[model samples]
Target: MTTATIAKPWYREFWPWFLMAGPFLAMVGCFITIYFAFTQFSNQPIQEEGLVKRGLVIEQQGAGAARQAAVQSKP
Candidate 1:
């Protein structure tokens, strides 16, 4: 009887190459995507005036004046 040789897979054969390559490819892809995003962002600059900035602005009208007004305005 002849002994059969085990055939390795393409991925298995390429495992070390993939091990070194996978992260490198991912990093390159990430940088490319980031560059594209930044380029698009820079190309179309955001309009500060058009955007609806949702928040609150509490100006102290004046504590003494506010107190006087509250007292005067009370029914």
Candidate 2:
């Protein structure tokens, strides 16, 4: 009688690397996102248009609240 044994490398199997790739890529993506988030910030002053945009937003919010109050007061 003869017996034979086969030795296989771990990376030759599909499942282990497949399972690992997801979190490995996710961690890489996380680090990239964090790097961009931290490094991309700037201290430049807001443009004049941005201030006007904020004022318009505030006006719209006040108008919406007044409309809501008027509707609620009716019934």
Candidate 3:
């Protein structure tokens, strides 16, 4: 006995659409992220002197953290 197979078009299949859903959602997410990055995030110009100022602030913070650590270690 021989069997007969029925052929169907690609669009009528479920797997193609199922596989495409992930990439479609990813592309949509990327577009939304880009929109927010341009509109919501800040565009700042940092001056050369600002680098020194930032470094000084970070150094002071590190010194404070070190003092805290030293005090904690005394116990």
Candidate 4:
């Protein structure tokens, strides 16, 4: 005697769709991230007041050091 068994089509199976879900969701998330990145931020430069203050402080320190060196050199 001989026996035969019938198999279901690939689309009706469970594991193939399960395996595909990861990359599909990842692609969706990637597009969402790209959309938000372009829409949520501005193209203008940031304000520079903090940097200007820092530069002024550095210049004052250099001048103070030079004045101290001049006083020490005069015996």
Number of clashes in every candidate structure? 0, 0, 0, 0
On residues 1-75, what C-alpha lDDT tens digit does candidate 1 reach at each position? 999999987667877786889899999999999999988755553335334233443334456677899999999
Question: How do the residues 6-70 of candidate 2 rate in per-residue lDDT, one tens digit apiece?
Answer: 97899899999999999999999999998986788433333452242342352224456778999
In model 2, the runs with Cα more than 4 Å from the true position are 1-5, 42-75
What are the lDDT scores of the predictions, listed in order?
0.71, 0.70, 0.73, 0.71
The candidate that wins on TM-score is: 4
lDDT sort, best first = 3, 4, 1, 2
How would you order the candidates by TM-score, starting with the best?
4, 3, 2, 1
Cand. 1 Cα-lDDT:
0.71
**Lowest-sum lDDT 10-residue window in model 3:** 50-59
**Each prediction's TM-score against the native?**
0.36, 0.47, 0.51, 0.53
Candidate 2 achieves a global lDDT of 0.70
Q: Which should have the higher TM-score, number 1 or number 3?
A: 3
RMSD of each: 10.5, 10.2, 9.0, 10.1
Question: Per-residue lDDT tens digits of candidate 4, residues 1-75?
Answer: 877778999999999999999999999999999998778844433335333233225222445677899999999
Name the TM-score of candidate 1.
0.36
In candidate 4, which residue ranges exceed 4 Å CA deviation?
Answer: 42-75
Name the regions of candidate 1 deviating beyond 4 angstroms: 1-14, 43-75
Worst 10-residue lDDT window, candidate 2? 50-59
